[model samples]
Target: MLWPREAGKFIASKARDVKINMEGVRKVAKVIADAVQEGKMDVKEFKQNEVLPINKGLTTAQLADWMFLINTLNFNFWTPDGVPKFSIEYEGKIHTGYLAMVACVNRAIDEGKKMYDPHYYSKLTLDDIKHIFRSDTPSTMPLFDERVRVMGEVGTKLIEKFDGSFINILKQVSGSAMKLVELVISEFPCFCDVAEYEGQKVAIFKRVQILAADLWMLFHGEGLANFTDIDQLTMFADYRVPQAMAYFGALEYSDSLHQRMVKEELFKSGDREEVEIRGCSIHGTELIVEETKHVMAERGMDVVGINSISVDYFLWDYRLNNAKELEKIPYHRVRCIFY
Candidate 1:
């Protein structure tokens, strides 16, 4: 089995439906490199991005457990076409997509629910989820049953094996992000976000990596959250990031595939086209990071905290900020718990 980085390159090499444009990769990288050199983009920006929930009065351990629970149910927030996106109203602002998911959790907490505690959520039922995650809009969160099941699975495991706190699991990593990622995948079967393509097992592990990234950002890389190998995490291969790459011209789909995507045709989780798009997105991001480093080197500027996760955060935020400009590009859709 190939892990995400190697699997990405291998799948991109053999891809038939998706292609990576090296020139476009360098093009975006140059833009990002300039931002980094000018101090416009870095880890600080990631932590302070408006999309993230405010962290004023929350404790680190509470924040850690919240992130763990959120990432567990983070998959499949994309709504069907023409639906008002699953949204939530909080603090006089409306949030959609991933932000809405985060808001719903915070709202539940404010309503006196111990949402961050595994013991509380592990016993929740389907009706409980519907009420807690009740949308401000007409559209409900997708995969509701699966979300409840995943919550129970991970929450129960934490109670039984990790002393009822995700912080215990983090303690076992000893400041290694990769080990934490591995432990998350090994200990919780719901987090094993892997698939098979052309007779080889490929691990995308999107939510697991995002879990680590969220924890690291939440703690500002201090205390139990410091991870030496945090850079090993690749860009999460999701629908939106690929759209950003395509908008920048870094990723290109075949005419057939592009037409299918434009038509909003849903692909199964492990379809060849889906795998190629996701894998190529990962490899394409690695190229972007490399080119950014090269450009930074040429300018003699040592941009601190330049890595795949940081770049991923930048690109993801770029997509959110430029959603209007990127609507021309179609994103591949796969309604699975893995992405």
Candidate 2:
């Protein structure tokens, strides 16, 4: 089964063994209620145009190119031992991690490179890509070689199969988010995010789902990016959102697992404990969505627009807004391309 569908099935079968607190679900609902009351919980608040690099004055095609490449290399920015973050200095401003990657791509476009052309990147050299993503500081981007390989793979696939544009790929899906997810994973091996849990394979598809979500947000659910099944996407299962979930008391780790996380222990990809953390976070967010809907309906507020995607946006933004407080909770550490 694909993610979210498989995720929901897993939760149904095993959530009783996981430590999900209904009180925590209600607490998140209250937070959403306050934000809604203050007119701050709008789903538009999470749109990519607000944070995308060089977002102004871009045509729809350009935006699709930018989002495609950005999501292609978005993974594992967390570093240890006080290393400076992966950052890019563009137009006198410094951007970090994912934003920094976008800045670099935009900068490449400014330099007269046809960055959106797969033919351009498919034949790119190591030095060329390094210069494109050059950091402002001595600390380089993590997983440099892997990033190059994935970019090359994506560019080659796009050129060979999709007429060299992500827009073409979107057209193939015909505005179905679930179909897009299936196509992305099947076509791009790098976006394949599967894990084994209790001897059963579980799909996460974190990056691909977020890529779809980004498209939905960027196009405001219209035009070529419109997806009829947009609500099918779950909260992107990742390290940061799980940290927020832990802080909000929506997720609790076993004592042994908590100690491992606090100690900054490294977990191999698909490790049982790591899978549990991510899986539970996905399931817990699903519950929070339900709880929030119930709370809103009980108050005679409209629940027409509420969905897991918007709820996830609220939770992710809440973590960023309260990073100081949430930092006390350690996120499970797993370094992999899946997230």
TM-score of model number 2: 0.92
Clashes of each: 0, 0
Q: List per-prediction Cα lDDT, in the order shown.
A: 0.87, 0.78
Candidate 1, poorest ten consecutive residues by summed lDDT? 47-56
lDDT by residue for model 2 (116-146), tens? 7678877787788889888888876677778
Give candidate 2 misplaced runs (Cα > 4 Å): 8-18, 53-57, 89-94
In model 1, residue pairs whose N, Cα or C atoms come closer than 3 Å (at least 3 residues apart or on different chains), thus clashing, are none
- Cα RMSD of all models vs. native, in order, equals 1.6, 2.3
